[model samples]
Target chain A: GAGVSQSPSNKVTEKGKDVELRCDPISGHTALYWYRQRLGQGLEFLIYFQGNSAPDKSGLPSDRFSAERTGESVSTLTIQRTQQEDSAVYLCASSLARVPYNEQFFGPGTRLTVL
Target chain B: AQSVAQPEDQVNVAEGNPLTVKCTYSVSGNPYLFWYVQYPNRGLQFLLKYITGDNLVKGSYGFEAEFNKSQTSFHLKKPSALVSDSALYFCAVKRDDKIIFGKGTRLHILP
Candidate 1:
Protein backbone atom coordinates (compact mmCIF):
# COMPACT_ATOMS: atom_id res chain seq x y z
CA GLY A 1 0.00 0.00 0.00
CA ALA A 2 1.09 3.59 -0.55
CA GLY A 3 0.54 4.47 3.12
CA VAL A 4 0.74 2.72 6.48
CA SER A 5 -2.17 0.42 7.32
CA GLN A 6 -3.50 -1.03 10.57
CA SER A 7 -5.85 -3.93 11.20
CA PRO A 8 -8.70 -4.52 13.63
CA SER A 9 -9.82 -0.90 13.40
CA ASN A 10 -11.76 -1.52 16.62
CA LYS A 11 -11.38 -4.24 19.23
CA VAL A 12 -13.41 -4.96 22.36
CA THR A 13 -11.77 -7.35 24.76
CA GLU A 14 -12.47 -8.63 28.26
CA LYS A 15 -10.31 -7.76 31.18
CA GLY A 16 -8.45 -11.07 31.26
CA LYS A 17 -8.19 -11.58 27.52
CA ASP A 18 -5.23 -10.76 25.34
CA VAL A 19 -5.24 -8.81 22.11
CA GLU A 20 -2.96 -8.24 19.17
CA LEU A 21 -2.89 -5.22 16.86
CA ARG A 22 -1.19 -5.27 13.50
CA CYS A 23 0.54 -2.57 11.44
CA ASP A 24 1.83 -2.65 7.86
CA PRO A 25 4.26 0.15 7.22
CA ILE A 26 5.00 1.72 3.88
CA SER A 27 7.03 -0.52 1.60
CA GLY A 28 10.77 -0.35 2.17
CA HIS A 29 10.54 2.17 4.98
CA THR A 30 13.30 1.66 7.52
CA ALA A 31 11.73 3.16 10.65
CA LEU A 32 8.48 2.07 12.30
CA TYR A 33 6.97 3.42 15.51
CA TRP A 34 4.09 2.55 17.82
CA TYR A 35 2.23 5.01 20.02
CA ARG A 36 -0.78 4.96 22.29
CA GLN A 37 -3.31 7.79 22.58
CA ARG A 38 -5.28 7.69 25.77
CA LEU A 39 -8.39 9.65 26.59
CA GLY A 40 -7.53 13.27 27.49
CA GLN A 41 -3.82 12.63 27.01
CA GLY A 42 -1.21 12.96 24.31
CA LEU A 43 0.29 10.28 22.13
CA GLU A 44 2.64 8.20 24.24
CA PHE A 45 5.54 6.48 22.54
CA LEU A 46 5.39 2.69 22.86
CA ILE A 47 8.26 1.29 20.87
CA TYR A 48 10.45 2.08 17.88
CA PHE A 49 12.05 -0.17 15.28
CA GLN A 50 14.76 1.10 12.95
CA GLY A 51 15.98 -1.43 10.46
CA ASN A 52 18.16 -4.16 11.98
CA SER A 53 18.95 -2.19 15.07
CA ALA A 54 17.50 -3.23 18.42
CA PRO A 55 13.94 -2.06 18.95
CA ASP A 56 13.70 0.63 21.61
CA LYS A 57 11.17 -0.40 24.24
CA SER A 58 11.80 2.34 26.71
CA GLY A 59 8.39 3.94 26.35
CA LEU A 60 6.42 0.73 26.84
CA PRO A 61 4.26 1.12 29.94
CA SER A 62 4.47 -2.39 31.29
CA ASP A 63 5.75 -5.93 30.85
CA ARG A 64 2.37 -7.06 29.51
CA PHE A 65 2.81 -4.84 26.47
CA SER A 66 5.08 -6.14 23.73
CA ALA A 67 5.53 -5.57 20.00
CA GLU A 68 7.53 -7.15 17.20
CA ARG A 69 8.30 -6.20 13.62
CA THR A 70 9.56 -8.51 10.93
CA GLY A 71 12.18 -7.33 8.40
CA GLU A 72 10.86 -3.74 8.33
CA SER A 73 7.54 -4.90 6.98
CA VAL A 74 4.70 -5.99 9.24
CA SER A 75 4.52 -5.37 12.98
CA THR A 76 2.28 -6.65 15.73
CA LEU A 77 1.53 -5.22 19.18
CA THR A 78 0.35 -7.63 21.82
CA ILE A 79 -1.19 -6.82 25.16
CA GLN A 80 -1.82 -9.47 27.79
CA ARG A 81 -4.39 -9.28 30.56
CA THR A 82 -6.12 -6.27 29.11
CA GLN A 83 -6.99 -3.58 31.62
CA GLN A 84 -9.34 -0.63 31.50
CA GLU A 85 -6.38 1.71 31.41
CA ASP A 86 -5.20 -0.03 28.25
CA SER A 87 -8.22 1.11 26.30
CA ALA A 88 -7.04 3.60 23.70
CA VAL A 89 -6.06 4.03 20.09
CA TYR A 90 -2.85 2.38 19.02
CA LEU A 91 -1.12 4.19 16.18
CA CYS A 92 1.68 3.12 13.89
CA ALA A 93 3.96 5.18 11.69
CA SER A 94 6.85 4.68 9.31
CA SER A 95 9.41 7.02 7.76
CA LEU A 96 11.43 6.61 4.58
CA ALA A 97 15.02 6.49 5.81
CA ARG A 98 14.98 7.02 9.59
CA VAL A 99 16.76 10.31 9.02
CA PRO A 100 16.51 13.32 11.28
CA TYR A 101 14.19 15.37 9.09
CA ASN A 102 11.96 12.67 7.60
CA GLU A 103 8.30 12.86 8.57
CA GLN A 104 6.32 9.78 9.48
CA PHE A 105 3.34 8.33 7.61
CA PHE A 106 0.61 7.22 10.00
CA GLY A 107 -2.04 4.57 9.88
CA PRO A 108 -5.72 4.97 10.63
CA GLY A 109 -5.03 3.37 13.99
CA THR A 110 -6.47 0.45 15.96
CA ARG A 111 -8.94 1.41 18.63
CA LEU A 112 -8.88 -1.05 21.53
CA THR A 113 -11.62 -0.98 24.10
CA VAL A 114 -11.19 -3.20 27.12
CA LEU A 115 -14.21 -4.21 29.04
CA ALA B 1 13.33 12.95 29.56
CA GLN B 2 12.07 14.83 26.52
CA SER B 3 8.76 16.62 26.79
CA VAL B 4 6.37 18.79 24.77
CA ALA B 5 3.79 21.24 26.08
CA GLN B 6 0.67 22.80 24.58
CA PRO B 7 -0.48 25.30 27.13
CA GLU B 8 -3.89 25.93 25.66
CA ASP B 9 -6.55 23.28 25.85
CA GLN B 10 -8.61 24.96 23.17
CA VAL B 11 -8.43 27.97 20.88
CA ASN B 12 -11.36 29.54 19.09
CA VAL B 13 -11.03 31.72 16.00
CA ALA B 14 -13.48 33.13 13.51
CA GLU B 15 -13.52 31.81 9.97
CA GLY B 16 -11.06 33.63 7.70
CA ASN B 17 -9.23 34.93 10.72
CA PRO B 18 -5.61 34.08 11.38
CA LEU B 19 -4.93 31.36 13.98
CA THR B 20 -2.02 30.20 16.00
CA VAL B 21 -1.48 27.05 18.08
CA LYS B 22 1.32 27.36 20.55
CA CYS B 23 3.82 24.63 21.45
CA THR B 24 6.98 24.38 23.50
CA TYR B 25 9.52 21.64 24.18
CA SER B 26 12.35 20.51 26.42
CA VAL B 27 14.98 18.12 25.05
CA SER B 28 18.58 17.23 25.73
CA GLY B 29 20.13 17.85 22.32
CA ASN B 30 19.05 19.82 19.30
CA PRO B 31 15.27 19.72 18.78
CA TYR B 32 13.49 18.33 15.76
CA LEU B 33 10.13 20.02 16.06
CA PHE B 34 6.97 18.93 14.27
CA TRP B 35 3.28 19.76 14.11
CA TYR B 36 0.47 17.28 13.45
CA VAL B 37 -3.27 17.56 13.01
CA GLN B 38 -5.95 15.02 13.85
CA TYR B 39 -9.54 14.91 12.79
CA PRO B 40 -12.06 13.15 14.97
CA ASN B 41 -11.84 9.35 14.75
CA ARG B 42 -8.65 9.58 12.66
CA GLY B 43 -4.97 9.23 13.25
CA LEU B 44 -2.57 12.13 13.30
CA GLN B 45 -1.26 13.64 10.07
CA PHE B 46 2.04 15.43 9.89
CA LEU B 47 1.78 19.15 9.15
CA LEU B 48 5.34 20.51 9.10
CA LYS B 49 8.73 20.28 10.74
CA TYR B 50 11.73 22.40 11.68
CA ILE B 51 14.91 20.37 11.41
CA THR B 52 17.67 22.84 10.72
CA GLY B 53 18.26 25.85 8.54
CA ASP B 54 15.27 28.15 8.51
CA ASN B 55 13.20 28.93 11.57
CA LEU B 56 10.06 29.28 9.47
CA VAL B 57 8.78 25.98 8.09
CA LYS B 58 5.78 25.60 5.84
CA GLY B 59 3.78 22.42 5.69
CA SER B 60 0.64 20.84 4.27
CA TYR B 61 -2.75 22.58 4.29
CA GLY B 62 -1.26 26.04 4.23
CA PHE B 63 0.10 25.59 7.75
CA GLU B 64 3.37 27.13 8.91
CA ALA B 65 5.40 26.99 12.11
CA GLU B 66 8.30 28.96 13.52
CA PHE B 67 11.08 27.43 15.57
CA ASN B 68 12.60 29.50 18.35
CA LYS B 69 15.70 28.07 19.97
CA SER B 70 15.96 30.38 22.94
CA GLN B 71 12.30 30.07 23.87
CA THR B 72 12.16 26.38 22.81
CA SER B 73 8.91 26.89 21.00
CA PHE B 74 7.51 25.68 17.65
CA HIS B 75 4.24 27.44 17.17
CA LEU B 76 1.92 26.47 14.28
CA LYS B 77 0.17 29.26 12.42
CA LYS B 78 -2.20 29.76 9.53
CA PRO B 79 -3.12 33.02 7.85
CA SER B 80 -6.78 32.11 7.52
CA ALA B 81 -9.10 29.69 9.23
CA LEU B 82 -11.98 27.77 7.75
CA VAL B 83 -14.83 25.84 9.26
CA SER B 84 -13.19 22.73 7.94
CA ASP B 85 -9.97 23.65 9.69
CA SER B 86 -11.45 22.88 13.08
CA ALA B 87 -9.60 19.91 14.51
CA LEU B 88 -7.11 18.81 17.13
CA TYR B 89 -3.51 19.91 16.82
CA PHE B 90 -0.50 18.30 18.40
CA CYS B 91 3.06 19.55 18.76
CA ALA B 92 5.95 17.18 19.16
CA VAL B 93 9.69 16.98 19.65
CA LYS B 94 11.87 14.13 18.48
CA ARG B 95 14.35 12.72 20.94
CA ASP B 96 16.46 9.79 19.81
CA ASP B 97 14.16 7.42 17.93
CA LYS B 98 10.90 8.54 19.51
CA ILE B 99 8.88 11.74 19.41
CA ILE B 100 7.30 13.19 22.51
CA PHE B 101 3.92 14.83 21.92
CA GLY B 102 2.08 17.55 23.79
CA LYS B 103 -1.39 17.13 25.27
CA GLY B 104 -2.91 18.65 22.09
CA THR B 105 -5.02 21.74 21.53
CA ARG B 106 -8.52 21.69 20.11
CA LEU B 107 -8.93 24.32 17.39
CA HIS B 108 -12.44 25.62 16.95
CA ILE B 109 -13.20 27.70 13.87
CA LEU B 110 -16.37 29.68 14.36
CA PRO B 111 -18.52 30.71 11.45
Candidate 2:
Protein backbone atom coordinates (compact mmCIF):
# COMPACT_ATOMS: atom_id res chain seq x y z
CA GLY A 1 0.00 0.00 0.00
CA ALA A 2 1.10 3.52 -0.73
CA GLY A 3 2.18 5.63 2.20
CA VAL A 4 1.38 9.30 2.63
CA SER A 5 2.79 11.52 -0.11
CA GLN A 6 3.49 15.25 -0.45
CA SER A 7 4.14 17.35 -3.52
CA PRO A 8 6.74 20.05 -4.27
CA SER A 9 9.48 18.31 -2.37
CA ASN A 10 11.36 21.63 -2.11
CA LYS A 11 10.26 25.20 -2.55
CA VAL A 12 12.31 28.39 -2.42
CA THR A 13 10.06 31.42 -2.21
CA GLU A 14 10.56 35.14 -1.71
CA LYS A 15 9.42 36.67 1.49
CA GLY A 16 5.77 37.77 1.33
CA LYS A 17 4.93 35.25 -1.35
CA ASP A 18 2.26 32.69 -0.73
CA VAL A 19 2.95 28.99 -1.10
CA GLU A 20 0.63 26.02 -1.15
CA LEU A 21 1.85 22.53 -0.28
CA ARG A 22 -0.17 19.48 -1.13
CA CYS A 23 -0.62 16.15 0.61
CA ASP A 24 -2.30 12.89 -0.33
CA PRO A 25 -3.29 10.72 2.55
CA ILE A 26 -3.60 6.99 2.40
CA SER A 27 -6.95 5.79 1.18
CA GLY A 28 -9.65 5.76 3.85
CA HIS A 29 -7.63 7.66 6.43
CA THR A 30 -10.18 9.90 8.12
CA ALA A 31 -7.72 11.84 10.19
CA LEU A 32 -5.18 14.16 8.56
CA TYR A 33 -2.65 16.39 10.25
CA TRP A 34 -0.10 19.04 9.31
CA TYR A 35 3.08 19.85 11.15
CA ARG A 36 6.09 22.10 10.74
CA GLN A 37 9.64 21.04 11.50
CA ARG A 38 12.05 23.92 11.79
CA LEU A 39 15.70 23.12 11.31
CA GLY A 40 17.03 21.29 14.35
CA GLN A 41 13.68 21.68 16.05
CA GLY A 42 10.81 19.42 16.98
CA LEU A 43 7.59 18.92 15.08
CA GLU A 44 5.13 21.77 15.56
CA PHE A 45 1.51 20.82 15.26
CA LEU A 46 -0.25 23.03 12.77
CA ILE A 47 -3.78 21.83 12.22
CA TYR A 48 -5.80 18.66 12.12
CA PHE A 49 -8.91 17.36 10.34
CA GLN A 50 -10.89 14.44 11.62
CA GLY A 51 -13.86 13.28 9.64
CA ASN A 52 -16.71 15.84 9.49
CA SER A 53 -15.84 17.52 12.75
CA ALA A 54 -14.57 21.07 12.71
CA PRO A 55 -10.84 21.30 12.15
CA ASP A 56 -8.62 22.12 15.09
CA LYS A 57 -6.93 25.42 14.37
CA SER A 58 -5.56 26.23 17.78
CA GLY A 59 -2.09 24.97 16.89
CA LEU A 60 -1.83 27.17 13.83
CA PRO A 61 0.98 29.65 14.46
CA SER A 62 -0.59 32.69 12.84
CA ASP A 63 -3.10 34.03 10.39
CA ARG A 64 -0.67 33.43 7.58
CA PHE A 65 -1.15 29.73 7.93
CA SER A 66 -4.26 27.85 6.85
CA ALA A 67 -5.17 24.44 5.53
CA GLU A 68 -7.99 22.79 3.64
CA ARG A 69 -8.89 19.19 3.03
CA THR A 70 -11.15 18.10 0.23
CA GLY A 71 -13.21 15.29 1.67
CA GLU A 72 -10.86 12.89 3.50
CA SER A 73 -8.21 12.31 0.91
CA VAL A 74 -6.16 15.38 -0.04
CA SER A 75 -5.05 18.33 2.03
CA THR A 76 -3.27 21.58 1.34
CA LEU A 77 -1.31 23.76 3.71
CA THR A 78 -1.13 27.35 2.64
CA ILE A 79 1.09 30.10 3.91
CA GLN A 80 0.19 33.59 2.85
CA ARG A 81 2.77 36.36 2.80
CA THR A 82 5.36 33.90 3.91
CA GLN A 83 8.13 35.05 6.20
CA GLN A 84 11.70 33.97 6.67
CA GLU A 85 10.63 32.54 9.98
CA ASP A 86 8.27 30.25 8.11
CA SER A 87 11.10 28.43 6.42
CA ALA A 88 11.04 24.78 7.41
CA VAL A 89 9.88 21.36 6.36
CA TYR A 90 6.12 20.93 6.34
CA LEU A 91 5.03 17.38 6.99
CA CYS A 92 1.63 15.76 6.50
CA ALA A 93 0.33 12.67 8.25
CA SER A 94 -2.81 10.56 8.44
CA SER A 95 -4.32 7.89 10.62
CA LEU A 96 -7.53 6.10 11.40
CA ALA A 97 -9.35 8.68 13.44
CA ARG A 98 -11.74 6.23 15.05
CA VAL A 99 -9.01 4.09 16.53
CA PRO A 100 -7.39 5.02 19.79
CA TYR A 101 -3.63 5.55 19.80
CA ASN A 102 -3.38 4.88 16.10
CA GLU A 103 0.04 5.50 14.62
CA GLN A 104 0.34 8.27 12.07
CA PHE A 105 1.89 7.68 8.66
CA PHE A 106 3.89 10.68 7.44
CA GLY A 107 4.64 12.11 4.05
CA PRO A 108 8.12 12.85 2.73
CA GLY A 109 7.47 16.54 3.48
CA THR A 110 7.80 19.74 1.48
CA ARG A 111 10.77 21.86 2.44
CA LEU A 112 10.03 25.56 2.22
CA THR A 113 12.83 28.08 2.16
CA VAL A 114 12.02 31.76 2.11
CA LEU A 115 14.54 34.25 0.85
CA ALA B 1 -0.61 22.30 27.65
CA GLN B 2 0.72 18.94 26.57
CA SER B 3 4.40 18.89 25.78
CA VAL B 4 7.42 16.59 25.49
CA ALA B 5 11.10 17.15 26.16
CA GLN B 6 14.23 15.50 24.83
CA PRO B 7 16.91 16.54 27.31
CA GLU B 8 19.88 15.63 25.13
CA ASP B 9 20.30 17.29 21.79
CA GLN B 10 22.59 14.51 20.62
CA VAL B 11 23.94 11.17 21.79
CA ASN B 12 26.78 9.07 20.40
CA VAL B 13 27.35 5.40 21.09
CA ALA B 14 29.57 2.77 19.58
CA GLU B 15 28.06 -0.09 17.64
CA GLY B 16 27.16 -3.18 19.73
CA ASN B 17 26.74 -1.02 22.84
CA PRO B 18 23.46 -0.19 24.50
CA LEU B 19 21.70 2.99 23.35
CA THR B 20 19.18 5.16 25.09
CA VAL B 21 17.45 8.34 23.96
CA LYS B 22 15.52 9.92 26.76
CA CYS B 23 12.14 11.66 26.62
CA THR B 24 9.78 13.12 29.19
CA TYR B 25 6.28 14.43 28.68
CA SER B 26 3.44 16.27 30.41
CA VAL B 27 -0.21 15.67 29.64
CA SER B 28 -3.48 16.25 31.44
CA GLY B 29 -4.89 12.70 31.36
CA ASN B 30 -3.46 9.24 31.00
CA PRO B 31 -0.41 9.62 28.76
CA TYR B 32 -0.11 7.89 25.43
CA LEU B 33 3.60 7.83 24.69
CA PHE B 34 5.03 7.11 21.26
CA TRP B 35 8.45 6.98 19.63
CA TYR B 36 9.33 7.75 16.04
CA VAL B 37 12.51 7.69 13.96
CA GLN B 38 13.39 9.93 11.05
CA TYR B 39 16.19 9.15 8.65
CA PRO B 40 17.89 11.91 6.72
CA ASN B 41 15.67 13.34 3.99
CA ARG B 42 12.86 11.06 5.05
CA GLY B 43 9.58 11.29 6.88
CA LEU B 44 8.98 10.01 10.38
CA GLN B 45 8.46 6.29 10.95
CA PHE B 46 6.52 5.00 13.93
CA LEU B 47 8.69 2.96 16.26
CA LEU B 48 6.54 1.91 19.21
CA LYS B 49 3.96 3.17 21.63
CA TYR B 50 2.86 2.78 25.23
CA ILE B 51 -0.87 3.02 25.66
CA THR B 52 -1.10 0.59 28.52
CA GLY B 53 -0.10 -2.85 29.81
CA ASP B 54 3.59 -3.82 30.05
CA ASN B 55 5.98 -0.98 30.69
CA LEU B 56 8.49 -2.36 28.18
CA VAL B 57 7.23 -1.76 24.63
CA LYS B 58 9.13 -3.38 21.76
CA GLY B 59 9.27 -1.76 18.35
CA SER B 60 10.81 -2.04 14.91
CA TYR B 61 14.48 -2.86 14.32
CA GLY B 62 14.95 -4.38 17.75
CA PHE B 63 14.20 -1.09 19.47
CA GLU B 64 12.09 -0.71 22.57
CA ALA B 65 10.94 1.91 25.05
CA GLU B 66 10.23 1.87 28.74
CA PHE B 67 7.30 3.83 30.07
CA ASN B 68 7.94 5.06 33.57
CA LYS B 69 4.77 6.56 34.93
CA SER B 70 6.32 8.01 38.07
CA GLN B 71 9.16 9.60 36.10
CA THR B 72 6.89 10.67 33.23
CA SER B 73 9.58 9.38 30.92
CA PHE B 74 9.55 7.16 27.84
CA HIS B 75 13.09 6.49 26.78
CA LEU B 76 13.99 4.61 23.61
CA LYS B 77 16.47 1.79 23.98
CA LYS B 78 18.23 -0.88 22.01
CA PRO B 79 20.54 -3.50 23.49
CA SER B 80 22.98 -3.50 20.59
CA ALA B 81 23.37 -0.34 18.55
CA LEU B 82 23.99 -0.33 14.82
CA VAL B 83 25.52 2.35 12.64
CA SER B 84 22.45 2.29 10.48
CA ASP B 85 20.42 3.37 13.47
CA SER B 86 21.99 6.83 13.41
CA ALA B 87 19.16 9.27 12.86
CA LEU B 88 16.76 11.67 14.54
CA TYR B 89 14.54 10.19 17.25
CA PHE B 90 11.36 11.82 18.46
CA CYS B 91 9.13 11.21 21.45
CA ALA B 92 5.50 12.18 21.16
CA VAL B 93 2.40 12.25 23.31
CA LYS B 94 -1.20 12.15 22.18
CA ARG B 95 -3.73 14.30 23.99
CA ASP B 96 -7.16 15.58 23.09
CA ASP B 97 -6.84 14.31 19.54
CA LYS B 98 -3.62 16.26 19.01
CA ILE B 99 -0.13 14.80 19.06
CA ILE B 100 2.79 16.70 20.49
CA PHE B 101 6.40 15.84 19.61
CA GLY B 102 9.49 16.72 21.56
CA LYS B 103 12.56 18.44 20.25
CA GLY B 104 14.12 15.36 18.71
CA THR B 105 17.40 13.81 19.79
CA ARG B 106 19.99 12.97 17.20
CA LEU B 107 21.47 9.49 17.69
CA HIS B 108 24.88 8.80 16.25
CA ILE B 109 26.00 5.20 16.33
CA LEU B 110 29.73 5.10 15.71
CA PRO B 111 31.01 1.91 14.22
Strongest candidate by lDDT: 2
lDDT of 1 by residue, B30-107 (tens): 889889999987778999888888999999999999998999889999999999989999998887767788989999
Q: Write the per-residue lDDT of candidate 1 for residues A1-115, one digit (tens) a residue.
A: 5789999999999998999999999998999999999888889999999999999999899999999999989999999999999999999999986746788889999999999
User: DockQ for each of the predicted structures, in order?
Assistant: 0.76, 0.73
Best by DockQ: 1
Per-residue lDDT of model 2, residues A32-104, tens digit only:
9999999999999999999988899988999999999999989999999999999999999999873247899
In order of appearance, the predictions have TM-scores of 0.96, 0.97
Q: Model 1: residues >4 Å from true position, as ranges?
A: none
- Prediction 1 global C-alpha lDDT: 0.91
Candidate 1: chain B TM-score equals: 0.95
lDDT of 1 at A26: 93
The residue pairs that clash in candidate 1, if any, are none
